[model samples]
Each structure stands twice: as structure tokens, then as C-alpha cells.
Target chain A: MTLETTLAAIGPADEQAMAAARELQGRLTKPAGSLGVLEELSVRLAGLAGTCPPPMPEPAAIAVFAGDHGVHAQGVTPWPQEVTAQMVANFIAGGATINAFARQVDASIMVVDVGVKIPLHGGENLLEANIRRGTHDLAVTAAMSEDEALTAIQVGLSVAGALVEGGAKCLLTGDMGIANTTPAAALVAAFTGASPADVTGRGTGVDDETYERKIDVITKALALHEPDPAQPITTLAAVGGLEHAALAGFILGAASYRVPVIIDGVIAASAALVAAALAPNSVAAMVAGHRSAEPGASVALANLGLTPLLDLGLRLGEGTGAALALPLVASSVRVLREVATFDSAGVSEK
Target chain B: MTLETTLAAIGPADEQAMAAARELQGRLTKPAGSLGVLEELSVRLAGLAGTCPPPMPEPAAIAVFAGDHGVHAQGVTPWPQEVTAQMVANFIAGGATINAFARQVDASIMVVDVGVKIPLHGGENLLEANIRRGTHDLAVTAAMSEDEALTAIQVGLSVAGALVEGGAKCLLTGDMGIANTTPAAALVAAFTGASPADVTGRGTGVDDETYERKIDVITKALALHEPDPAQPITTLAAVGGLEHAALAGFILGAASYRVPVIIDGVIAASAALVAAALAPNSVAAMVAGHRSAEPGASVALANLGLTPLLDLGLRLGEGTGAALALPLVASSVRVLREVATFDSAGVSEK
Candidate 1:
């Protein structure tokens, strides 16, 4: 399908689904009409699924899409690509908060090595790091070719699909990659028409000089590529990393498959913007978990009209924030499925 | 035991637990050290229980303590004491945010009227409400009688005991009551030695005149009852509600039972102060869920050295904030239980 038609034909927010969602507010064990918007969240999801209350499942999958940015050489983040690999090891080791939370909540995790400079030793992590090493220096050229971007997306689709087939009830998007915020800044600035300065944050707590250099590099790259927003694939091709491309596809695929996807922070947010650009209704399957302390995150999420639940000065970009927020999403669905109606509970309405 | 000894006897922080908590941060599925405090949360929990990774069960219970103040008659609150009963219906009906969130997260909710001036229906919920009608006007007499205050604490202990017996793995504390902030305000002032004028806030969005009067009433009440901090029960007897006293007991019981308790906003914080006074270790059982817009919540939590997660500018009290924060706590436990170790995942870790 043509990219525009592909974008246009995605699902809309079904009125029937919304109606079903509203009905669930009154049906759980507690009094009806008491849960407020959390009930609405559940109902909304139910309506989308054409179910009463949605089923929340164990064996959930989180994809920590990792990539490397050319900007790392520019000295924005003090950590090197080796640290990314080391972190991947840490995630696999079960020492991370996401690991702890994932276990506590009984979910599985897959670390997607999307574009690390090092050859990752893959036992279980889906090595979708297609560009072998990392993105091309955005200051010098486009981040990745259109073909590579498309391949990254295919990688995301495969991971999400396999998880769903393996009984994943939900999809959550996470990302890893040192200096990846450079690419995210490019995407946000391009898609949302924000200034590079506005979208660029002191990623990994960079100093004022490095922050200025990072912003300049991104601004320069966006000018060179001049990525087109109307054509999501082209824009992703222009400036997106393999991780961002994969995340966009992951979001779209989850929606197409009819499972909910929870979006993480800026990198995820920028990728989600691409998915939205591709298919408007794909936003329906997405929930904004927590707003990151990252500037671009809030800008992207707000532009898309999604409300984030928590905003605790958190700027970390693993699906950790998203993972942190998942229980709330689960809770939203539970309210739809569990709360009792007024007549059943013998309680009066407000 | 003397109240002083009982408070002192509450267990102190176990360094072994803190170290174990920190170690677990190294094992989760995300990058090493990414989940930060959330990882530590589980680890500390594990250390407290003396388990490598703790047990997570299906059933959980949340207790909401509600109390009214005679200070309400001083024109502090915009709402009346009667609203406490109405909102109790709201909680039961699932119309409240806490109800929506609790059902979402799958926690059983028990509401205690504690000291609401009005009576509830002659039914099961009424049995749990624990309303001694209401507190005495602190401006005139001590808000609660010494005997009544102790009885309220017994009520909290009994409820917590029942939940544990029923196999709850977690305990969450929240509260309701129109004008109860006056009692909360008085408690903050008496304990922190902050000026009553600084601690007294507009309860439930009062206008400027009402706020000024609130400060006046709290100041007068403290003057009337130069409550001793050393005698916590006596202090609570002078200015606390049945719910406040009960909440303190609930926290201690949860700690004693080794169940984690999520403390909600200002009223919960006030009760937590009493809890800390009773036993320093009880704070270990507590997780400060969210800092509410209530001016006193931070002051109280700061006094206890707990950092809040969500900061949604919420003033509505119902244990809703705590309920919302449950997913993170559950994840903390999950990280402990589920994340694969480095050896098993075959990933290298330093």
C-alpha cells in the first residue's frame, strides 16, 4: 500500500468500542460510577477491543531497543558504547529495576540490540542492531538509509508478533543506546516543528558546553535531511535510528494485532510520533505511561494529545518508566472489569 | 509497654537488608543500575524479610482511615463533616479515584469511618467504618478521648490482622474526612514545632478568610492542649482522631506482619508521624506514595525521610495515590523474584 493510504487505513476509535468501555464502568464489584477516568481508561480499552473488561495476562514482554548514535563521539554523554553493552548484561543479570519490576509483575523481557557499535553476544536478546555498529554521524549524513529503517521496523513487528503469539497480553516499548537522544532530538524537531534547542536535553546529564554542541549537531542534521513528517517512513529513513524505527513499527504492529502498547519516554515518544504519522488510529492502542523529565518527551506526548500519569523528574529511557507505569494501565483495565454497578451494589450515584 | 518503649522497640533499619536491596539492583533485566530507587525498594524489602527475593501473593488489602475534627466547626473546611459519610459512600460505590485505582490493581479495600460525626448504614461497611460519630472540637476540648483514641488503634490493628489472616501480601493506608485536615494540621504543628499558622492549611479548598480562621483555630487548639510529644497516645488523645490513632496502629501492625504499607496523602502522613513516634521502624513498612498538594504532606513525609513517587497535585484523600503506586511496588517485588541472573542469562556482568 502507498505510505499515505497505509497511514490512512489504520483503525479509528470505534464508537461501539467506546460504548462498551462505558458500560464496564458500572459492572465491577464495587459501586458504579465511582472510579472516575481510570474507569474511562478501562472502558476505552474494552471498547477498542470490543470486550467487556480487557484481559491482563502474565508473560508480558518488554523490548529494550538499544542503538548507538554518531553523536556519542561528540562528547555529550560521558559513557561509551561499552557501557551500553555492559548495561545489556546488567538487564540480563536481573539487577535492573525493570528486571525486578518485571519479575514482580511476572513479565519477560527481550533486549533488542538494534544498532550497537560492538558485535553483541546474542544468547536471547534479539539482535536487530541492523547497521552493524551504529548510526552514521548525523552531522555529516542521514542517520540510516530508508531500506535499513524499514528493516528495523520489520524487526520490531517480528518481536511484537512473536510475543503476542506466545501469549503476551500487552506490549511495552523501551529503548537503550548511548547518545541516542541526538537522533530523538532530530525526529522531535522535524516532526513537531520544534527548535532543536527546545527538543535537545542534557542527555545523561551533560554540561552546558556539551549540551550546546549536541543541540548544534542535531539542528545541523535536521537541516541537511529536512525529513518529511507527512511520509513517516521517509522521515524515519532520514534521521531515525534502528531503535526508533523499530519502536514505531512495534507500536503499529501492536495496534494492528489488537494488543495495547504502553509508550515510554522521549525515544519511544519520537518513534510513536512516527507511528502516528503512519496511522492516526494507531494512537488508540497506545497509552502514555509516565512523562519523563526529558523535554522532548513532554513535547511529543502533548503534541499527540496523550496524558501521562507520573512526572517524577525521571529522564531515564529504558522502558523502565513505562514498566513502572504498566500497573496503572493494568489497574485501568481492572476497574473496567471489576467495579460493581450502582444497582448491584445498592449505592446511589453522585 | 510504655508508649515510649513501644515506639522505641519498633525495629530499626537492617543494614543487611539495605545491602541486599542494593545488590539486587545489579541483577534485574534492564541495564545495571537503571531502575535506581525502585530496585532498592525491592532489595530493602527483601533484606527486611531476610529473603533473597520475597514472596508476592495475589491478595492484598488497603485500609482507608477517615476522621472528622471538631476543628471543622471553627470554619476551617469548605465542606461539612457530613460529606465524610457521603464520600464513604463514594468510596464504597467505586466513584472515587482510589476505588478506580484499587480495582485496577486488584487490592481489597476496607474503609474506616474512624471519627466521622455522622453514622452509616447498619451493615457490613458500617462495621468497618469505625466511626465514634466524630472527634471533639479541638478548639474546645481534645479531639478524641484517651480511651476512644486507644480503641481506634485497636480497630486498625484488628483490620490489619484480618487482612493478613486472609493472606494479603501488602497493605495500603488512605483516609477520608471533611475538615480532618484541621486535626492533621494540629498534629503537624505539635510534633514539628512549626508554627500552627505555618502548618494549618485550607482544608478542602477553603477561601482566604476560611484559611485564616483555620490557622486561628489550630493555634487556639494547641494553646488549649500543650500536648506532649513524648506521650504519643496522649498527644493523639489531645488532637488526633480515631482514624489517626488507628492508622498509626495499622502501620505498626503491617510492619510487624512484615507487609509493606503504601501511605497516602496528608491525613495518612499525619498518622505516619504518629506511627514514627510510636516506632521508628514502622516508617520502614511505609512507602510514601505521593506528595499531595496539601501543604502539610511534604512537611510530614520530610520529617519521616520518605520521598514520594507521584506528584499529581492531588488533594483528594482516599488511599487513591497509594493504590496508583502499587504497581511500582509490585514491580519492585517482581524484580526480586523474576529477573534472570547473569549466570542463567549467559550475559557478562562486571
Candidate 2:
């Protein structure tokens, strides 16, 4: 489906289903409003699914959209750009942290070459959806053309659709891009109207000198772009990575399909800002999986009215947060579907 | 092991292992201190286990200690007193919310009839550890005799030992009682030096009238007992439930063995207070699984210097919160053990 059609079709969550879920929560054999956020989350999922006790969000998929960033030339992060491709290879070879976490949670991983500068040969689990060689250095110029940004977004949309069609009840956003956090902080500042210094954080353990440079890079990019929040595409092309654009499309696609999308850290949160700008209602399908250690993540999540399910101080960006959260998400749904109501359990309610 | 010997044997966590774990965290292929609380948690676990990347806490066991409370006569909760025994049966039948959550986390459940008023027959997973029929009315007199309280604590200590011996690596605390929250709140206030009004909360979704009455009941019980924080056993016998005393023993047992104990809600937190008072070092083995909606839970947790892993507003007491947190706990350890170090992954360090 076209991005425009998906955005146009996005609607608010189903109020009737939400009410049903709330009433059901009260009837469960526990104290009223005792399950706390899990009770609220289950109701929200019901609204998204348009049913009480919504379908279990199982057979989860984590899409690791790999890319390279021209900002890597700015010496923003200590890691080499080639590490993105190497990590992607590690992910496919089941040697990365995300792979280990996904295996534990029974989640499948899909790697998409959205804009990797290196030529990634065909692999069993890799999707060759490269939109370009890599984004231009956002500190010096717009990261990508509007068309390139849109193509990357469509790649995310297609991946989301394919995963959902393949019976993935939940989609998790993952990303692998060198110096990606530079553009991520810039995008978050552009969308959330936060100052670059407030949102920019030390990415990948930068030294004091490199940390200051990273912030300066983001500040310069925002000044050069003067990104309009109303024009998400222009802002995205100006300061966002290809993977970020794709993540936004993936979120939009999940919203169109009424499936839950568990967003990862700073990169995914910044992408969510772009998705929310395009279709505010799409935020209904999003769940902040965990609190990223990055300062920008808190700003983005707060602006989106989302509270992360876990806050274990995670900053790894390869959908690691989402994979760690998979079991909690599944448990939330199981609480709704499997927990017996007071009447069913023959227990008196307070 | 005897309670006194166990308490005496409990020592500080292994500082050598903790330092090693911290050094290992720095080598992981992510930003320094990027994993946030998980990194801290892993180091803590390593200290407890006396090794870096401590053994995985799997094959978890949730001990649901069922009991009745004389506070049921105080009109605190609307539910009938018989529901406690009935729910115990439901737990054993695997029909309760805790059962469902335990299944989701692949953890086993064990129901202990610590003080159920009614005599329970044979059940496959039920442990006949009943100390007495139930505790006396706390508002009028001591909840249990000193001997009864000691016996109940021993029951918990034994359960912890048995579970650890049976190949379970982690122990989660769960409890069932009709008006247990009344004692839980009182225990928390007595231990934490908080005022009854500040620590007391509506239990099992009580009406305004019942909430006010509940607070009054706790106030009156405290006035009569005048529990001494310096004498934890006195406080426990004066106002705590049988299951609460046992849970405290369970926590102490785990600490003595250097095994992790994930405490559930207010009841478990209250028990933790007793455990901490009895053996201050026991808190090292404890992890607040989630923030209980009950105000007393927060006060107890804060006093213990423990931050819950999950705070989904859960007030359900049957180890539901701990069950939800099991996967996250496993992931925390797994991240430390499985995530490739920077040098091992051939990734450049910042």
C-alpha cells in the first residue's frame, strides 16, 4: 500500500473495544485497578485490535534496518562505518546480543539493507531494500533527497506488511547505522523542539572531546536544515538516516494494519516522531519498549505521550530493547486472554 | 538450616566477583554504562553468585503461601473470607492470574497452606505447611504467638531450601490472604517508621468507607502493639500474617544461600522488611520485582534501597508482578553473559 493511503486510513483506537477491555479488567479475579499499567496496556491493545482480550501478540518479528551514515565522516562516533555491516553479519550469524535475546523470546530477526554503503551480498535472512549508498552528511547538507527518504520509508512499510502477513502478531523496530545517533538527536530536536544540547548524548561511549563534537554536529545540522515539523518528509530527508525513515514507515504500516509496534531506542523514537507527524493517530499502534540511556529518547517518548514498558538503562539500538520487552508484551496479552474473571473463577469481587 | 544459623551465615556480596563483572561490562560491545540498570543488576548478581556473568536464574519457582487473616472481621475488604481458600484451590488448579503468568515465564508454582483457616485436602502441588488455622485478630491482640510466628518463618526457610535444592535457580514470593494487606501496611509502617496514614492504602479495591476503616484498623493495631523496629520478630508476631513471616524467612534463606529472591507486592515487601530487620545483609539477595500499587509497598521498597524491575502498577499479590519480571531478570544476566565484548566482536571502542 502507498504511504499516503496508509496515513489516510489510520484512525483512532476503537473506543468500544477499550471500554470492553476496561470492564473485563474489573471483572478479573483481582483487586480493581490493581494490575496497574498492565491493566491500562491491555485495554489499549484491545482498542488497537478492536476487541476485548485482543489476540496474543506472539510470533514476534524484529526488523533490523541496516544503513551507513555520512555523518560518520564527522568523527561523531569512535566506531568505523564498516562495523554496521559487520554487526549485520553477526546478527544473521546469531552472534549478536539481539540475536541471543530474540532466540530467548522466540522472536525472528529480519535484516534490511536500507542504505548500507558497503555491498552486502545475498544472505538467507537479509532483505536487499537499499534505497541509496548512504545518506549525505547532515552536518554539511541534507541527508537525503525527499524521494530517497520516501523510498526508504516504503521499504519499511513493505517489511512491516510482509512480517504481518507472515503471521507476526507484533513488530519491533531495530536499526544498525554508524554515527546514526547524530542524525537521531537532530531529528528529535527538530520534531520535539528541544535544544540540541539537551537532546544530544554521548553515542557509543565517545570521549569528552568527541561528545562535544557530536553535539556540535547535531546543532549544526538543525541550524542548516531549520526543519519544519509540518513537513515531516523534508525534515526526515534533511537530518534522518535511511533506517530511521524506514522505521517510521514500518510504524505507519503497523498502525494501518492495527498491529502493535514496539519501538526501540533513540533511532526508533526519532523515527516515531516523523511517523507521528505524518499521522498522529499512528502513535496508537506504538509501544515504547524501554527507556534508552540516550537523553533524546526521553524527550521523544514524553512528547509522544508514551511510557516505556522497561527502563533498564538500555542504549543498544539494534532492537535490543524491543527484544528484551517481548516477553512482557506477550504476558500483558496473556493476562487478558488467560486470566479468569471473578465470576468464572467463582471468586467474590470487592 | 536453623533461622539463626542462616542469618549468621549471610555475608556481604562477593566484592571480587562484582569488580570483575563491572570490568566485563566495560568490554561489552556497547557504550560504557549504556545498558543502564541491567549492567548494574548483572554486577550485583555476579557478586551474589561469586562469579562474573553469574549463572542464569532459570527454572524459577513461585511459592504461593496461602493464609487467612482475622482482619477479615474488620470490614476492610468486601470479599468473603472463604475466597482465600477458594483462590488457593484455583492457584493449585492453574486457573489464577499468577498461574497464567507463571506459565508464560516457564516457572513452576507451589502453593503452601501456611495459615488457611479451612483445612485443605490433597493437591498435586500443595505443600502442607500450615502453622495454625489463622492469625488472631490484630486490632484486638497479637496476630500470632511468638512460637507460631517462628514456626511459620521456618516453613518459609525450608521452602526456599527445598526449591533451591530441586534445581530452581530463582525463588519468587507470592501470598494469599483475605485481609493481608491490612497487616502488610501495618508491618511496613512499623518497620519503616512511616505514619499509618502515609503508608496505608485501599486493598482489593475497597470503597471509601472501607478504606477509612482500614486505616483506622491499622492505627488502632499499631497503638496496641507498639511494634519495635529493633525487635523484628516482635513486630512480626504483633501485626504480620503467617504468610508474611514465612516470606521473610524465605528471603533470608535465599540470602544465606546467595540466591536471588524476587519479592512480589506489598505483602512480600512487608516480609522483606522483617527479613531486613532480622538480617540486614539479607536485602542483598532481594530484588523488588515490581512496584505494588499499595502505598506501603513503595515505602517498604524505598526503605530497603531496592528499585523494582517493573512498575506496571500491579497490586495483585500472588507473585503476578514477580512472574512478569522473570524474563527481564533472565535477560539481564543473559546480556552480561552472551553479549560479545568489543574486542571479541572486532568492533572499535570509543
Candidate 3:
């Protein structure tokens, strides 16, 4: 489906289903609201599915969208741009941190090369959906043209549709792009109208000099583009990476399909800002997996009004945090579906 | 083992192993310290196990120690005391929230009747290890004689030993006691030097009048007992519930066996305070599962210097929160064990 169609299909969560879920939650053996955020999560998911006790978010799939940032030349990060392709290879070879997490949680992995600078060959679980060799340096010019940004988003959108059609009940976002956090900070600043200094963070453990340089790079990008939050696609085109555009599409696709999508760290959070701007109701389908250690993640998540499930100080963007949260997400729904009511269990209420 | 023997067997975790684990974490494929709290968790586990990459904390066993509080008569909670016995039956019958969560995480449940006011019959997964009918109301007098408290603790010790002997690698704490949070608050106040007004919270959703009365009850208990924090046994016997005493012994037992124990809500946190006091090194074996919405839990955990794994506003005290955290605890160790080193993965570092 086209991006416009996907955007149009997305709507607000079903309030009736949420009401039914809240009622059901009250009757469950546990005290009303004792399950805490899990209770709210289950209700939100029910609303997303338009039914109480939404389908078990099992058979989870993670799409690791990879790209390269022309901002690498700005000395914004310490890692070489080639590391993006290398890590994608690590993910496909089942040797990356995300792979280990997916294996632990029993989720499938899909690696999409949306804009890696290096030419990546076919391998298991690899999807060649590269939009370009790499984005233009955001500090000098728009990261990508409007057409390229839209095409990359379509890549994310189609990937989500394909994963759901293949029977994935839940979708997770993963990202792998060297120096991508630079663009992520730029995107966050553009969408949230926050200062670049406040939103920029040292990605992949940059030294003090590189971290300051990273902040400088983001400030320059924002000043050069003057992106508007009202125009999400144009803002994304100005400051976002190929993978960021795709992730926005992926989120929209998940919302259009009425499935819960777990957002990763800063990259996914920036993408989510775009998706929420495009379709405000898409926020209903978004689940913040964890609070990234990256400072910008908190800013972006606060703007989106999302509470993360885990806060293990994780800054890895390869969906590792999201994968770790899958079991918690699944348990929230399973409690709604499986736990007996006080009446059914013959347990006295307060 | 006797309580003295168990205490003697427990010591500080292996610092050498912790150092080795820290060194190993630096070589992992992910950026240094990117895993955040997870890296620290893995290192702690290694120290507990006396080796790098500690044994996977799989085959987890949750011990739901059920008791009744004479405080029920003091109107600290709205739930009937008999509900404690009913919930034990539900736990044994696999119909409770803890049972559902245990099933979700593939952990086994063991419901122990430590000191229910009502006599409970045998059922699947039920252990009749009762020390008495229940504790006296702390607001009126000491909750239990020193002897009764020690015997109750032995019940937890033996249960933990049995579970570990039966091939369980990780232990989780659960509690089912009507009005138990009353004693929990009292214990926290005693151990942490916090005031009743600061530590007390509405258990199972009490009304405004009942909440004020509950705080008054706790304040009266602390004033009467004058419990000393240094003498954990005396403090626990004065204001703790039978389940809280058992949970303390259970935590000590896990520490003695070198297995991690995931502490649940306020009840378990208060008990953990006792355990940590008795054996200061026992903190090494403790993992705070989640910060309960109950106000006292934070006070108790803060005194123990433990940062909880999840903070979902949970108040249910049947090991539900710990069970939800089991996967995350396991994944921390799994990442340490499975994720390849940068050298092994042929990935360039920054």
C-alpha cells in the first residue's frame, strides 16, 4: 500500500474495547490497577486490536533497518561508516547483541539495508531495500530529496505489512547506522522544537571532543534546514537518515494494520515523532520499549507521551532493548486473557 | 541447614570473578557500557557465581509464602483475612496472577502455608510449613515471639534449600497475607528509620479514612516496639509478619546457596531489609524485581541500596512482579554469555 493509503487507514484506538478491557481488568483476581503500567498496556493493546484481550503479541518480528549517514564526515562519531555494513553482517550472522536478544525472546529478525554506504550482498534474513548509497550531509544540504525520503518510508511500510502478513502479531523496530545518532538528534530537534544542545547525545561512546562535535553538527543541520514540525515528511527529509524515514513508515504501517509496534531508542523515537505528526492516532499503536541512555530519547519520548517498559540504561539501538521487553508485553496481554476472575476463582474481594 | 549455619555459609560475592566479568564486558561487540544497568547486573551475577558468565538463572522457582496478619482485626486493609487462605488455594490451583506470570516465564510455583490464620489443606504445589496460625497485631503487641519468628524463618530456609536441591537456579519471593502491608510498613520504618507517615500506603486500594487509619496503626506499632535496626531478628519479631520472616530466611537461603533471589513487592522488600541486615553480604544475592506502588517498598529498597529492575507501579505481592522480571534477569546473563567479542565478530571498534 502507498504511504497515503497507510496514513489514511490509521485511526484512533477503539475506546469500547479499552473500556471492556478496563472492566475485565477490574474483575481479575488481582486488585484493581495493581498490575500498574501493565494493566494500562493491556488496555491500550486491546484498543489497538479493537477487542478486549488483544491477540497475544507472539511470533514477534524485528526489522533492523540499516543506513549510513553522510554526517560521518563531520567527525560526529568515532566509528567508521563501514561499521554499519559490518554490524548488519553481524546481525544476519546471529552474532550481534540484537541477535542474542531475539534468540532469548524467540523473535525473528529482518535486516533491511535502506541506505548503507557499502554494497551489502544477500544473506539469510537480509532485505536489500537500499534507498541510496547514503544520505547527504545534513549540515550542508537536505539528507535526502522528498522522493528518496518517501521511497525509504515505503520500504519501512512494506516491510511491516509483509511481517504482519507473515503472521507476526507484534512488530519491533531495530536500527544500525554508523553516526546515525547525529541525524536522530537533528530529527528530534526539528520535530520537538528543542535546542540541538539539549537533544544531542554521544552515540556509540564518543569521546568528549567528538560528542561536542556531534552537538555542533546537529545545530548546524537544524539551522541550515530550518525544518518545520508541521511538515513531518519535509522535516524528515531535511534531517533524517534513510532508516529513520523507513522507521516512520514502519510505525505507520503497524498502526494501519492495528498492531502494536515497540519503538526502540532515539532513532525509533525520532521516527515515531514523524509518524505521530503524520497520524496523531498512530500513537495508540506505539509502545516505548525502554528508556535509552541517550539524552535525546527522553526528550522525544516525553513529547510523544510514551512511558517505556524497561529502563536498563540501554543505549544500543539494534532493538536489543525492545527484544528484552517482548516477554513483558506478552505477559501483559496474557494476564488479561488467562488469569481467572475473583468470581471465577471464588476469592473474596476487599 | 540451621539458620546459624546458613548465615555462616554466606559471605561477600567473589570480587575476583566480578573483576573478570567487568573485563569481559568491555570486549563484547556492543559499545562499552552501552548495556547500562544490564552490564552491572551481569557483573553482579558473575560475582555471585564466582565466575565470568554465571550459570543461566533458568528453571526459576517462586515461593509464595502465605500467612495472615492479626493486623486484619485493626482495620488496616479492607480485604477479609480469609482471602489470604483463598488466594493460597488459587495459587496452588494455578488461577492467580502469580501463577499466570510464572507460566508466562516458564517458572515453577510453590505455595507455602507459613502461618495462615485459617488452616489450609494440602493441594498441588502446596507446602504445609506453618509455624503458627498467624502473628499478633503489632499495634497491640509484638507480632510474634522471637522463637516463633526464628521458626518461621527456618521454614523459608528449608524451602529454599529444597528448591535449589531440586535443580532450581534462581529463586523468587512471593507473599499472600491480608493486611500484610501493615507489617511491611512497620518493618521498613524500623529498618530504614523512616516515619510511618512516610512509609505507609493504601494496600489493595483503601479509602482516604482507611489510609489515615492505617498510618496511625503503623505509627502506634513503631512507638510501642522501639525496634532496633541493628538487631534484625528483634526488629522483625516485633513488627514483621510470618511471611516476612520466612521471606527473610528465604533470601538468606538463596544467598547461602549462591543463587540470585528476585524480591517482589513491599512484603518481600521489608523481608529483604531483614536479610540484608542479618548478613550484609546477602545484598549481593538480591535483585530488586520491581518498585511496588506501595510507598514503603521504595524506602526499604533504598536502604538496601538496590535499584529495582522494573518500576511499573505494581502492588500485588504474589511474586507477579518478580515473575515478570525473570526473563530480563535471565537475559542480562545471557547477553554476557552469548554475545560475541568485538574481535570474534571481526567488527571494528570506535
Which candidate leads in TM-score?
3
**Whose DockQ is higher: candidate 1's or candidate 3's?**
3
Candidate 2 stretches with Cα past 4 Å from truth are A121-123, A207-212
lDDT of 3 by residue, B19-72 (tens): 999999999888899988888999999999998989999999999999988888
Q: What TM-score does chain A of each model score against the native chain A? A: 0.92, 0.99, 0.99
Please provide, for model 2 over A1-350, each residue's C-alpha lDDT reduced to its tens digit, 9 standing for 90 to 100.
99989999899999999999999887877777777777888888999999988999988999999999999999998888888887887777766778878877889999999999988867889999988888899989999999999999999999999999999999999999988999899999999999999998877777899999998888888888899999999999999999999999999999999999999999999999999999999998999999888999999999999989988878788999998888888888887898887787777655
Q: Assess candidate 2 and give its lDDT.
A: 0.90
What DockQ do the predictions score, one after another?
A: 0.27, 0.62, 0.82
Which residue pairs in model 2 clash with each other?
A36-B313, A37-B312
TM-score of each: 0.80, 0.96, 0.98
Q: Using DockQ as the measure, what is the rank order of every candidate, best first?
A: 3, 2, 1
The model with the greater lDDT, 1 or 2, is: 2
lDDT of 2 at B325: 85
> Which window of ten consecutive residues has the lowest lDDT sum in model 3 chain A?
A216-225
- Better candidate number, 1 or 2, judged by TM-score: 2
